[model samples]
Target: MSETVTLPRPDDWHLHLRDGAMLTAVAPESARHFGRAIIMPNLVPPVVTGADAAAYRDRIMAALPAGSRFTPLMTLYLTEETDPADVVAAHESGLVTAVKLYPAGATTNSASGVRDFTRVHGVLEAMAEAGVPLCVHGEVTDPEIDIFDREAVFIERVLDPIRHATPGLRVVMEHITTQDGVAYVREGGPDIAGTITAHHLVINRNHLLVGGIRPHYYCLPVAKREAHRLALRAAATGDCDRFFLGTDSAPHPDGAKESACGCAGCFTAPNALSIVAQVFEQEGALDRLEAFVSRNGPAFYGLPVNEDTLTLARQDAPVAYPDRIDAGGEDVTVFDPGFPLHWQVT
Candidate 1:
């Protein structure tokens, strides 16, 4: 076993850096560990065009802490009204690295998302022709499907048909959470990959209900069962190029998340690596940690691996709960912040 290891710094293939204050508050956490992150475009008035992506990129740049080496890879939010010409322009101009497809009403700020895949045929064709990837939310929004079964159902109903319609299009199944999701992405063939989030590797549905409902563990494509969590761990650590890291580290203001109708998202920025490291270590696959966290993402994105390096150590430590960046507003706790972590960032 390798006593110590270092690898190219990782990038977050999927992330939601909300605009303005929230953006300013959370951008630094990711910047601290990642060299680049594919920024999600689902803002209030989502980034639907090249100009919007460019402007959002500028905001992310300005928000970065001084001397931070982080780069924000922008994406266009795909809506039914998205123009094929705009997608072509964005890809050609290099303003966007990918296009995000959120099934309408799937998650936060996704009300503007495309309601029907058939309606965006031109945009998908344009993206494929331009060699840009389509990053999907990958869950059906229909009310009848059980919350836990939504992803599997979407894979069979929505994603399968979409893939059939656009044979050459590159796709990333964002934040995959189920065995079915893992299996689907695995069988979907090349030019297709899935991003596994750090939180899902650590928490399952039992964590949500066992000790009474834990609101902080709530996230879109909500945590699945222990079996699914185990499946995610195996996929992330296994020799599958189809899976990699995407923290999906969304933040919700304390008021919004702790309310009667609590929002779905975990502010996992602070404890992400530690949580992921713990998972790999528990599976006796710490040696494979670097690949899942550092290598697979850039390989899928077709970007060169990072030159910088980071370390993870087998040290038991406690990441504080209610992470406070300011006074009196409210304390924000990461998904598993209060718990003791067996692996720590070095």
Candidate 2:
């Protein structure tokens, strides 16, 4: 016998749909399941302006599969020189949904990220007034700080200060990977929310470092201790409206991932739903999966819940998933949860 659970078609609050060939290859994978996704703007040059967002949106739309209803919610990449007026105008005109803050050198293609947060104060203040949400990478790039401690240190130094300076700023702490991050968002008031990745819910530092280096499991705000992983799992499945799904499904060329200095991301878009279903079911919270994946994100972003639904069936046999996606001349590996997944998004 097979058990099934149906959910409102989910939206990925954080996603990276690279560009050109890569975009063409990966866009359909997400479109096949998700109704909408907050498209990342950290392109090589980055999507930093209204005109840039509009143009990028066109590219993304063209890349999507024919007749696909997947909507790409475009965002602007915040730099020290970002114009508050431009950000507000794009949001007002509906060309952009939010603005992303990547600390310089924090992650892939983030060299243009803010080095001095103060340089973007005006932009942040304007976003606060205009009701545009700020999606932050949430890790500092200080060389002295241990990689494992960056998220916690960032909370104490960068994020909290900015949030306090601009009181009404709606912020989404993207890809939060620490118990500290969990605590901050849980205690941080209504205006602040946190996004949990499908990979983070399943992997910890051990998953990344235990036997040997696992490049595919690496992501920015890298996975933390087992205790932190458990904290994230609880926050995701528990009764918290401020926490929701953000897979951060970044794709990298197979060579780029397996190189001497590999890229930091897990190409999880292909099997995100299956991985999340198993996690929620294990947590004994199947009733709440819809809220975490579908309802909460919309509630925080001021968007309506997706009207369509997708059903996941729990079958006797483990579902077989594709190992890699062919993109241009290279391959992008899909994330492996390191376990058998029985739920299939049918």
Candidate 3:
């Protein structure tokens, strides 16, 4: 007999809906499964001020499908020249949700990110005072540091110091990919939390480089060893409010991804809920699925749990999902979990 589970509609704590054609193509996929999402702010020029955030929010609303109730929670990309007053004003007006910190050259379109952390101290202080959370792309870009070691090094060299200096600052370490990251969040107080991506829970570095280089599986803070993957699985399945779903569902054109130097991201929004449900069932943590995807994120963000519900059912036949999302002129590949998916959102 097939089993089914129904829970409150989930919200994506971290998501990337690129502007223009890409946004129009993928926003509906997320809207179909999640009620809201914390939209990333690393566009070409980046969203760095209250006005930028407000205008971007308008574009997102315009891109949404007719009659869709999905809401985009906007964020500001932090830079050295970022005005603390602008961030406060944005939060007060509900034009922005949080501020994103991307270390210089850490990931795509991050060239404009902060190089000297001290320069943003005033902005961080203002965010703490306004009760606005800081969503961080937790990786250091020092060329000397190995790519796989960036996240772990970031915690010790950067994250810890910043949090210690700013009291009462709420932070969400976005897309944590290490055992060290899991342990840090497990031990942190209520003021700190971490978001675990859907793809990270399923793939490790081996999946990206085993027999051949799989660009579709490649992502920033690139997947770590199998042990780290297991740690991420445990954190996501455990009953901790600090750990929640964030599909970092980034999309790139096929040509761009298959090139000599491909971008780093996994496009998983098309079937994120199904992929996550399969993982939860495999780990024998199906009971905690609702809390992980629905309750915890809203509680951490100080928002209300969604009133609507989503239902997933296990079918005898494997679930079928589109292999790619057609973004106007280019095709964006969907993440393949290397296993047949049986659970599907209904």
lDDT of candidate 1 over 189-268, digit per residue (tens)? 89789999998988889888797788888898998999999999999999987799999988877777788988888877
Native-vs-model 2 lDDT? 0.94
Native-vs-model 1 lDDT?
Answer: 0.85
TM-score for each candidate, following the candidate numbering: 0.95, 0.99, 0.99
Which one wins by TM-score: 1 or 3? 3
Model 2, position 109, has a per-residue lDDT of: 95
User: Candidate 3 — which residues are off by over 4 angstroms?
Assistant: none
Model 2 ranges off by over 4 Å: none
In candidate 2 the C-alpha lDDT for residue 237 amounts to: 99
By descending TM-score, how would the candidates be arranged? 3, 2, 1
Task: For model 2, give the 10-residue run with minimal summed lDDT.
Answer: 1-10
RMSD of each: 1.7, 1.0, 0.9
